[model samples]
Target: MFGPDKCRSTDKVHFILQHKNPKTGKFVDHHLKFAPSVPYDKLSHVYTAILKPGNELQILVDGEEKRKANFLSADYFEPAFIPPKTIPDPDDKKAEDWDERDKISDSDAVKPDDWDEDAPMEIEDAEACEAAPGCGEWKRPMKRNPEYKGKWHSPLIDNPNYKGIWKTQEIDNPDYFELDKPDFEPITAIGIEIWTMQDGILFDNILIASDEKMFAASASSDVLSDCQKKVFDVLYKVADIPFLEAYKNQIIGVIEKAEKQPILTIGVLVSIVVVVATAILRLLFGRKKPQVSCNVGETDAPGNSEENEKNDASAPHPRRSRRET
Candidate 1:
């Protein structure tokens, strides 16, 4: 179904924050956000009986999916760490021979043959996947990175800890992390409550690590803040209410909160219009109301009746008389 705001779920989805490399201009790490969304597909199974209705439009975001990143604000700028194009790590073996003549699609490039649920991926196993006839034949798979520029990715990501083919530019953290003295100051991370657990901590699992690290909730059940705690509480009571009663005033509040984007956009637009109208009115009428003397002969102000009358009488109308304004 294509609506005007038809962005692929993967494309539109982004982390609440992404750490950047000050020197190069790249995001070093990213983490997801869990702000509530309009309630859609909510399924609850009670013991053997499943509760909660089954369908509505829903957005699914898979962390594994790939998409280009967009920087949201120009106010904040971070340099990206661009990996060196040439000089990949030198492996001990003859750089894993390449055939030099083939064109394989990206889908075929890194896929392992023995990727079945139970298949072994051990390099020493006899059943381990043999390189595709065209694998590395057309394009030799690149070597691991010699310097830890950031996270070690498969063929696409360079390895920083590699001791071969490259030298370390710096030892500890990269330089320029502080573009200025003020930029270097530490920022207290908000929403850290997302990382806590009932048992002091749910678990510490590093899902993505670069200069910065991204973590999953100690447990999916881990409530990191008052909000998440409320969500979890709602999950518990969702089934207790009758199907129709499930949507109480509390439900309306939650739904409205989720849909605040549209409401906020409207509010801002209205405020801008009001401000513009007020500015226009000020421009037309100055600020203090225009002064007018009602006396027919009054000379002080235009639009003053006294001024008008005075002018009229002097001009032979005899109706001009000065009166206190």
Candidate 2:
């Protein structure tokens, strides 16, 4: 079984080996838990565990070795089936006068003569009224009192009676047994028991084979490499913009190049400034025509009167003229 160390924890991964103890006839567990070297969320990752012939264990993530140790070593794995070789002595007991304290209060401490325990922590400012004249009834602000002294306490000193920690002697256990190769059980069934708050956990391409070469062949697929290539291509496209392609490698590279050729750097900066200033000038003042205004009561000119008489001689009158009668 493989899972996390606890519920809702995605930071660690654990591999458990369950088998029936030959001596005790009860089922036991051996756990190997560690933090993953690569991210295990929002992306597919390959997890592999290999048990070698010499009781050695190896854990890998994305075909990279992360943790390796001996399965029987007490430093790496938790062997719950094995009993301790020596147990604490039941007959041993601590002495009555055993002092475990490291420090005690000093007995020679005394209070100073000028220390005032009853003094207030703050006092009203006496010169506030004189500083600001005609300010109505100005309630003076309070300042920290210089004469106030906090409660006194004696300093601590090392205790001479300390005898250090007490411990009991060990004895050999009667039920202790040793196993050189604990991986002797036959493969029958496999199961997984897990508790996690995360959703949409996927398990794919699970391979259980006796030969290590078969497992290696399955793990060497192009899934992870293809994903990494796609991410790099996206970043390349985003950096391929005008005036940025020259420094697409990194911003630090641009600074180093600018330091080497200061003349070129100044020319590029002046060009950018000129382009921006021209755009601003066109936006503020462009494509506008002058407007003309005329007075409503202005008199007509002499050319306008002759044109009006010619127009009246060619028009028909509304009333009959007296010359026709």
How many residue pairs clash in all the candidates, one count each? Answer: 26, 0
lDDT of 2 by residue, 1-325 (tens): 6544434434666777876676677777877645444454444556788888888878777678788877677777676446688889788788899888889888887878888889999999876665666657667889999998887777889988988887887888765778777745776776666555776454556777888777677665513455444643444454455544444566334333333333234443444446545555666785566332233564447769787556555754434343235
The 10 consecutive residues of candidate 1 with the worst lDDT sum are 43-52
Q: Model 2, stretches more than 4 Å misplaced?
A: 3-7, 10-12, 19-27, 35-46, 79-97, 107-115, 123-129, 132-147, 165-183, 192-206, 221-325
Off by over 4 Å in 1: 1-13, 16-40, 43-80, 83-325
| TM-score for each candidate, following the candidate numbering | 0.16, 0.51
Predicted candidate 1 versus true structure: per-residue lDDT over 168-235, tens digit per residue: 23334334333221122244443323322222222123232222112222222221334543644554
Against the reference, the lDDT scores of all candidates come to 0.33, 0.63
**Can you give the lDDT of residue 222 in candidate 1?**
23
Give RMSD to native, each candidate: 27.6, 20.1
Q: Model 2: what TM-score?
A: 0.51
- C-alpha positional error of residue 118 in candidate 2 after TM-score superposition, expressed in Å: 1.5
